[model samples]
Target: MTKALKASGFLGLATMMAVGLHQFVILSGGNPVPPWMIGGHAHLGVLSILAIVMGFAVPALGVTGQLRTAVTVLYIAGQWGIPGIVWLGEGFGLTFLMPTGFLWGLALIASMLIMFYVTITGDGDAGDRGPTATAPADD
Candidate 1:
């Protein structure tokens, strides 16, 4: 699961960069796209964790199932599928959705990276070693 998460993070980041760049172009008036339409479009990229956790089971208890399912939606609709739809609609002509997809994809990757980091490192990525901090009654 850790390996998978790491891999996903890399893929998601790449997607985000591409989509984000395209979105930037459209927003900067490179094409006929309007600014208003692109607004809030990048958010999809920012909140992709929900979709990323779909395949793996989160820690805790039975709650992992629900959480994973919810996460899957973002991957299916927000990160992976929506971009194509957005492009089809106005990407060719220039719209925020087109570039937004790139951002979203990048965000997805970032989320995965963050998740792995948090889960593996605990302190935002330092590697698993400090038993003194986590050990229960070992003292």
Candidate 2:
């Protein structure tokens, strides 16, 4: 793997595991997530998976600004879309106590905005210089 790939790989692995753990937490049926992560388990679970996928794209975004922007759009969509849907669908759920689903939705919206910036400006292994940029330099 190239230096960029190697450097970013740890973040990728962490994100992937984090996503996978989020799923596991949800699937665990109140084991790890407690009462909060229940009910809308799918929403949180999907978000983590999206985060992991986004992490993979982070490295490729090292070159071209356009590809990174595209990744950002997708990231924002996935990040907020699922949570927003869940919050709207189950605003009355117990897990949505206190700040509630609306709060989560708001946070997700904010995150999407931040993601747009990160995707466009952040350097990643995803190689903004087109497909070849992602490929190993020695290859």
Model 1, stretches more than 4 Å misplaced?
A: 1-6, 22-44, 49-57, 60-74, 93-139
In model 1, the Cα lDDT at residue 123 comes to: 42
TM-score of 1: 0.36
TM-scores of all predicted structures: 0.36, 0.36
Q: Over the stretch 1-139, how does candidate 1's per-residue lDDT look in tens digits?
A: 3334434545655666676677778768857544433533453354334334433333321223444444443344445445454545464665544666665566456545544544664543233234323444666
Worst 10 residues of 2 by lDDT: 1-10
- lDDT, candidate 2, 1-139, per-residue tens: 2233333334444544565577686767765544323434445455655565555555543424564454445445545445444545455453434445455566556545655666676765345476544444785
The per-candidate count of clashes, in order, stands at 10, 11
**Pick by lDDT: which candidate is best?**
2
Over all chains combined, what TM-score does candidate 2 have?
0.36
Candidate 2 residues lying further than 4 Å off, grouped into runs, are: 1-39, 58-99, 120-126, 129-139
